[model samples]
Target chain A: MPDFDFAQPTSLNEALELFAADGEVRALVGGTDIVDQLKTGRRNADMVVDLKRIPELQRLEIEADGLHIGAARSLTDIAEFPVVLSDYKGLADSSVLVGSWQIQNRAGIGGNVCNAAPSGDTIPALLSHETSAIVASSSGRREIALSDFFAGPGQTVLQKDEILVELVLPPIPDDSASSYLRFIPRNEMDIAVVGAGSFLHLGSDGAVQKARIALASVAPTPVRARAAEGVLEGNVLSDELIETAAVAAVEAATPISDVRGSAEYRRELVKVLTRRTLGISRDRIVG
Target chain B: MKHISITVNGDQHELLVEANWTLLETLRDHLRLTGTKEGCSNGNCGACTVMVNGRTANSCLVLAAEMDGNEITTIEGIASQGKLNPVQEAFIKDGALQCGFCTPGFIISATALLQRNPDPSEEEIRTRLAGNLCRCTGYDKIVMAVEDAAAMLRT
Candidate 1:
């Protein structure tokens, strides 16, 4: 790891001030990703701007508009949080799948998104739920849809000197439920070969009023399968209906073969996961 | 070099270290607390696992300065007056170790899990120790040891 100055600012204003003074400062939250990058020589920042000390970035707030999850809030915090589990079960489940308990305890949601791995477990869940990132910079703050946040692999739309302040999940539509599912070669510790998340809203007559489906590790970025979602929207979920949607999801995937699994295998798993996730999500909508 | 002050195993030490030094390096080199072994310097392997602020963290992935105000418990802190902690004893009795290089981290990680879950199920024990790579013992004895320690802790 290259040498760097470390600064721990006690407040958001102070952290911003330090960031404004220097362009080379990189914010450090959980150290789950940054530390690994530093040690492996994959990343080198001249200064580490420690954001853990900033109290504002650690608060999780649920309000009338939506749920605001602090950028620095750890995955353990999300997985164990009752509101998250009860309201956004898909997100909670994804949080549990990230690395190990030790890593989950230190890994933050913002870091996961900003790391921008195609296999990032949280991205599919966020995209499925129509979440947006509340990004802040020295100049100002703005919101961007989670779908628009990722530019490509290991990249995001976040500008230099800007930090992700919070992930804002809009209020769940009535009679709606969401679920996330992933297939890995091993169990919880390993990254996903294919990940899928689904959100389904049912009408009074038990027909699907709206549907959202997102996939990960099968594309350049977490992608919403509009064709798959179109199959479910305004229709009733049946075994045959879900199979058609799942096939559509496979058509939407752009998986690349890697050490984890072959692109064809990933596409197959995406079909399986999409079917399973949609079934579970539909059940939640009805039950 | 950067001067950092951190409390390890309940003792405060003021020392100067390289700017890029990790908490694992600081403990093993600067303070000579060699009990915290370094495995995968990245967060994957838990050989450098330690309890920071009552939570298990990979010491190798954490900078020493990042833990200045936190309370850290390493493998060296598990024994009280030369007496093994119950978890350590359970590991020994259950034959949970083979090479013992990863023992310190396993002990620390298991202890932290027990601290949080008190009486975790067998599955919970396995999931919690997933980060700690133990090439030997096949983890059967390690899981048994944690279950034993949990029973001891409850009683």
Candidate 2:
């Protein structure tokens, strides 16, 4: 790692001020990703700002609008949170799969989103929940939809002086449940080959009222399978319909051939994961 | 260099650390607490595991400068007084180690699990310890050791 100045900012203002005056400053919460990147020289920083000490940055608020997750809270805290496990189960599921117990205890949801890894397990889950990013900089703050947040692999639209303050997830819909599942070669300590998250709402007529399905590792960024979702809504979901929707979910994927899997295999896994996640959400709602 | 005051294994140490120095490097170098082994140094292997404010974290992934005013527990801190902790004794009884490079991390992680969940199921133990990798002993013995530790601690 390059020699750099380190700043542990206790307030959001302090953090923003550090970034406001800095050269190559990187904001870190858990240090799970940034430390490794720095050690390997994949990323260099003139100064590294630690944000976990800020109290407001660690706020986990449940309000009428939705759940406001403080970006600096550890994944373990988020995943095991009562409200998250019960209301945002998909986020909980994906959060636990980020790394091992050790990593999970240190890694933060915001870090995963900010790292902007195409294969980040939590992105699809957050996207499926229609989450939004609340960012703050020295000048002001801005809100952006999670879908529009990512610029590319390992990139976000967040400016040099901006830090993501919170991720806001809308309230769980009525008659709805969400689930996230990912395909990995090993049982643990591996990145996703194909990850899928589904949020389903059913109506009295035994038809799907609303559907949101997002996929990870299929493109340069986590993407919503809107085509599949469009067809699922207002349709009476049968096994055949589910299978067809799964096939449609593959349309959003533009996966590359990598060591974990080939492009063809990833597309195939997308179908399976999409189907399974949808089925799990449906079952949770009905059961 | 930054001056940081961190409590490790109940001993408070005020030391100067480089901005780029990780908690693992600081523990092994400045404090001369070499019990926390460095493996992978990228959070992949848990050989550098330690308790930060009572939570298991990969020390290599943490900067020593950020740990100021925090309480940390390493393998060196687990055994109380002159007696081995239950987890340490159980590892010996179960013959859980081969090269033992990963033992310190496993011990820290297992001790943490037992602290959090005293009656964790077999699957729970396996899942919790999965982060600490062991190439030798095939993990069965380590799992057995955790189970044994839980039992011993319960008694």
Candidate 3:
């Protein structure tokens, strides 16, 4: 790794100013991925603008509309946060599935999205919740829907000058519950082979009012199975509907054979995972 | 290059390093704290584990500049006047180490975990030590060593 400069800004404005000053500067948070990339020569940046001291990006606030999770907030913080666990159990559970306890203590959600891995565990969970990213730049600020955030594998729509400040999770609709399930080879500290998140809303008649099914590690990016979602819409969750939805999920996937698993295995796992997650979401209707 | 000051093992030293220089490199190369081994510079092997402000972290994942003014405790800091820390003593008593290349990191990570959660379950120890890999000893004696050290601390 070449010798470079480091700047730690104490305020968001200062961090933004430092970023705006250098076109080659990269924002550093958590450093879980970037530091390793730098050492291994996978990434090269002339300057690193450290954002750890910026207080605003570390806040987790719950508002009337939804939950606002700071981009710099660590995975352990998300996993253990009471509000997160109570209001967004799927997201909390997904947070704990990342890396290990040590990595979870330091891996930031913002860094996860910014790093933009196809198999990022939180992507499916965030997609199920209808989350949006709050991106800030010196020029202004804007919100980008999480669904539209990722451009491709290991890429996002974030401009080099803009910084992701927070993730705004929309309120789950009434009578709706969500669950995230991922299949991995090992129990701890392994990446997901196939991940699925199911969010289902049941009406008074026990028919599905709204539904969302998102999957990771099955496509170029985290993808919503709209065809599968349509199968559950306005229909009571039955074994038949679940089977159709699960098949549709397989049809929606574009997984490739990798070191983790074969494309055929992932397609089959997609069907199984979709059924399991939908069942979990449907069973939550009892209470 | 970045110039930063860090307090390690109760002593403060200022040094200049690259933005990419990890705390592991800063400790082993710059500060000459050779006790902190560099088995895998990546975070996986965790041979460079250290306590940053009382929290255990992969020193290789942390940039030296990010640790400015932070308190870091390495394997060199765990003892006083050449006496072994209780965890180190337990490691010897339990024959927890064979190659000994990973002992400093294991001891540091285990000590940090036990300090925070003194009465950890066997599963808890396994979970916390997941990042720290031990190729030798098969980890049975290491687990027993941590339990023994916990009991020693309790008494």
Quote each prediction's TM-score: 0.96, 0.99, 0.92
What is the DockQ ranking, best to worst? 2, 1, 3
The residue-by-residue lDDT of candidate 1 on A137-243, one tens digit each, is 77988999999999998889988868888999989877898999899778667888899999888888777888899999999998999999999888876889999
CAPRI-wise, candidate 1 is: medium
- Which should have the higher TM-score, number 2 or number 3? 2
- Candidate 1, which segments miss by more than 4 Å at Cα? A21-23, B1-3
Over 4 Å off, model 2: none
lDDT of 2 at A264: 98
Ranking by lDDT: 2, 1, 3
- TM-score of predicted structure 2: 0.99
Which candidate number would show the highest DockQ if scored against the true structure? Answer: 2
Which 10-residue span in candidate 1 chain A carries the lowest summed lDDT?
Answer: A16-25
User: On residues B1-155, what C-alpha lDDT tens digit does candidate 2 reach at each position?
Assistant: 89999999999999988999999999999899999999998998899999999999999999999999999999999999989999999999999999999999999999999999988998899889889999998999999999999998898
For candidate 3, lDDT tens digit of each residue in B15-103? 88777778888899888899988887767887888888887778888888898888999999998789998899999999999999999
Off by over 4 Å in 3: A173-175, A282-287, B80-86
